[model samples]
Target: MIFLRYILLPIVPIYYLVTWLRNILYDFGIKKSVSYNFPVICVGNLSVGGTGKTPMIEYLINLLKDDYLVATLSRGYKRKTEGFQLANIDATAESIGDEPYQFYNKFKNDILVAVDANRNNGIKQLQLIDKQPDVILLDDAFQHRKVKAGFNILLTTYNNPYFKDIVLPTGNLREPRSGAKRANIIIVTKCPKDLSEAEKNSILKQVDPETNQHVFFSSISYSNSVISSEATKAVEDLEDFTLVTGIANASPLVHFLGDKGLKFEHLNFKDHHDFSKQDIIELNKRALIVTTEKDFMRLKQYESLKDKLFYLPINVVINDEVRINKLIKDFLKIKL
Candidate 1:
């Protein structure tokens, strides 16, 4: 893999130039972007995936759902269906992507969730609803420059900050690091629980945020129990099991489970991987199987594994959350 990355170095400049030109066109208004009157906050990343975007979106939903009519708009990646579609009782992971489907499963009664590759069209369709959302949360739509969000929250993992990386083909970045300037808030996700002040200062120096951007750090907090459709079990009570993960990065989760002195065989797959029938046949053999909440969304559809399959829930533990919550609320207040 390292050799392949080095071999692909020549293609990096071409990728960078293309993305740079696109951003320039948008920046100069050569390509117009639609802006709405109501609040539309975007949570996205400069790098590919695994920056805890879903958790961050859920955090915002939790923060504002009680006080405001919250709705989420996503591209509905990997879904069988296409175009603007609203989440309802018939929704499934295969219908609206895993993350958005997870959001609907959790917040169906409290918020509206919809998916469309064309974010501008999605927003317009959402506005046409009888009960319009007071605020719309754009999930993973930063590079979708066609629609301008009121607040942009860009996330990067602490271990692999975008500043230290180059563009795609050689590195993980989707655009130039300068593209981070568009974000109103920059969050360093997957930080250590005991991250020191000096370390934070070092990262801030590398980040070099502009005058308008606010930087924050967050760590993943794992739940004490693993949940399944049938029952919930305490993490400490789990025996030998199979750990399946189809996420961009599962290192943090592997480390978390290791720290708990648990024993399990890990079956790591590609991010957003679609499980084959044979995959289910193999997984059903295990006495107990553990997976991430997102993966559980897809796996839960199979009837054979319902009794043994369990997923560990995780949330982002933002440092100085009170301040971050205030910042989000303040932004919404201004937009309203």
Candidate 2:
């Protein structure tokens, strides 16, 4: 794969030219970039997928939901529908995409959640609702140059930092490393709990964060045990269960389970993999099938295996709470 990437280096110029032109068009007003009246916090990454944007968005929602009317907007990736659609009581994982649907179901009463391919149109639709939200959170939209955001939080996985990676066709970066300058705050997601200050300093040296930009580290926290679908038999005693996950980053989950003294046979798959009937049959061969909450959203459609399947929900916890809280307060105080 390294040799193949080098062979494909010639296309890098073309990619740069195309991105430059698109940015130029928006910069010179040749193309319009729209902004909503509400304060928007954009959680995104320079890579294509799996930077833990969804969990980070959820973290922000949990932090700000009490003081502000929070709304979430996503591009509705891989959904069956199109255009701006407000999530209703009947919204399913298939209708508004798995991530947004999960948010809607979890925070149904307190928050407003919608999905749209066009960010501006989605914000407009949300504004037309009975009670407009004070703050809107845009999920996975760093590269959406057509919509201007008030604050951009760029996330790069700790294992695969963008500073060390090259562009697409050569590396996993969606844009050049310099593109990181656009981010107001940088977060090293999916880091280990024991990552030392010296190691963090080295990473900051590589990232070369500007004086104005704040940097923070975070790790994933999995809930205790898997919740059964029947809501009766709690699988807290997990001595005979198999772990099955289809996320871009499963190492953290695996490590967390190990530290808990829970033994599990893991079946890992590529990110965003659509589970099939045969997959469910093979998974059921174990005593129980365990998975992440994100994967559970996709797997729940398998009515045949609903009784046997269980999920372990996860949350994001910032390592440096003091610095994170201060930065958030400063940002919130700014008049956009």
Candidate 3:
């Protein structure tokens, strides 16, 4: 597809101009953006997909959930459902999308997760409830200009910063690199665990954050155990298995497992890929199968794949925890 990429290079300027113009409208207030008294923290990326937004959102939830009534709103990507819908007992991966469903499942009875394509309407609905949340976390809503997030935590991968990338139809960026200026905090996701001070300074230099923006680096921290509905097993115990992945990037996971001296075959799928009946049959035939936490949320309901299906959980191991947490807290505390 390298040849196709070269062919698509010509359309890059068109895509770039369209996105740039849209941002200009949002920036200059030609388009109305709602600002709320309650804190709305947006964890999003300039690129199209998988910059560890989910883990970062979860991190913020964990940090503030105890002290604040926390709620999350997402676009509910690829779900069959439409409009504003708060997750309830009837909710499923098909209804509220995999990521939101996963959030509801994991944080049940603790946090509220809702989905809507119309973010402004979703916030209105969330705010209308009698037990209103003290803070709202907008999952993957940076580009949704209707609601101006109080704090924007923009994420990009360590390997490919947005500054070095071109717009869509050519590179993976969803918006122009100048869009990074809107972010209050910028995080370089998926850095090496042992990333050095000097290397981090180099990354910071490349990011070249504005005076108001704070840049941070983080790496993925994998759980020692793989979890299923019925049980959990140490990663080492699963020496051989089929790694079925429906994630944007699987390289970090592959390297992590390989480094642990594990033996496995990978069944790679696109990010947020939906499984078919035939796919289920094939997956059920495997002696053992492991998947991502997000993908597992979508696949777990298949009774055929239950006993063998397990998911590995991961968290973002920020380079400096104290400083980052303080920044988030301080931002939330602004005139509250």
Candidate 4:
């Protein structure tokens, strides 16, 4: 696959030109973008996937849910259903997608979670609700120019920043590196726990943020315990188990477990991969199974796997937490 992308490298210029022009059209107002009175914060990335979007979206939810009525809008990637859908009792990973379903299960009472491929129409449907949200967070719509987000919180992985990458087929980026200029805030996600000031400055130099953009660095804070519907167990207490993951990147989780001296065999799959019957049969052979919160949403559907299947939940731990919080809070306050 790595060789395949290089083989397709000639197309990069074509892909680059096309995406560039589309963004230019939106940027220069040749294409009209809808704006809302309430703050619309978009959390997205230039890369194709695994830049910690879900964790960042959850971070925003936790940050704003206490003070404002917050609603999240996402494209509901890989779900079976179509059109706008507000999470309800019947919601499932198959219905509204894994990440949104996770949001509904965890923070249903605190925030409203909705999914629609058509974000403009999604916002319209959300507006029609009895108590419209005071703020709407678009999960992954930096490229979705139909609705102009008031504050764009763009993310790039610390390991593979967009500036260091090329556009799709040849590399991971979904758009040209110049597209990052659209961001109000640029975050280097999945960084080292003890990221130093010198290192931050070095990364910032490479990212080359625009004059108005504020750059932040963050790492994943994994939970100490693994959760399942039946029970929970201390991560350290787990014996030999299979690490079943269907996420874009599993290296961080693998490294985390390794650092803890946990022993396990990994059964990796593509991101958002739906399990086949044979896949389940292979997974069921293991006595204990651990997965990500997103994969757990789909994997637990098998009754035979429910008792033993567990998932580790994680949060984005931003560096310089106080300053970052103040900056965002001030932006929201002034915007409102």
Instruction: Give the number of the best model, judged by lDDT.
Output: 1
Q: Give candidate 1 misplaced runs (Cα > 4 Å).
A: none
Give per-residue CA lDDT, model 3, range 207-248, as digits (tens). Answer: 888998899888999999999889999999996799999999
- Which one wins by lDDT: 2 or 3? 3
| Candidate 2 segments exceeding 4 Å error | 1-6, 28-30, 232-236, 259-261
Clashing pairs in 1: none
CA lDDT of every candidate: 0.95, 0.83, 0.91, 0.92
User: lDDT value for candidate 2?
Assistant: 0.83
On residues 224-268, what C-alpha lDDT tens digit does candidate 4 reach at each position?
999998899999998899999999999999999989999999998
What is the alpha-carbon lDDT of model 1 when measured against the actual structure?
0.95
Clashing pairs in 3: none
**Which of the two candidates, 3 or 4, achieves a greater lDDT against the reference?**
4
Candidate 3 local distance difference test against the native: 0.91
Error of 3 at 282 (Å): 0.2
How many backbone clashes does every candidate have? 0, 0, 0, 0
Better model by TM-score: candidate 2 vs candidate 3: 3
Best by TM-score: 1
CA lDDT, candidate 3, residue 254: 95
What's the true lDDT of residue 131 in model 1? 97
Q: lDDT at 178 for candidate 3?
A: 92
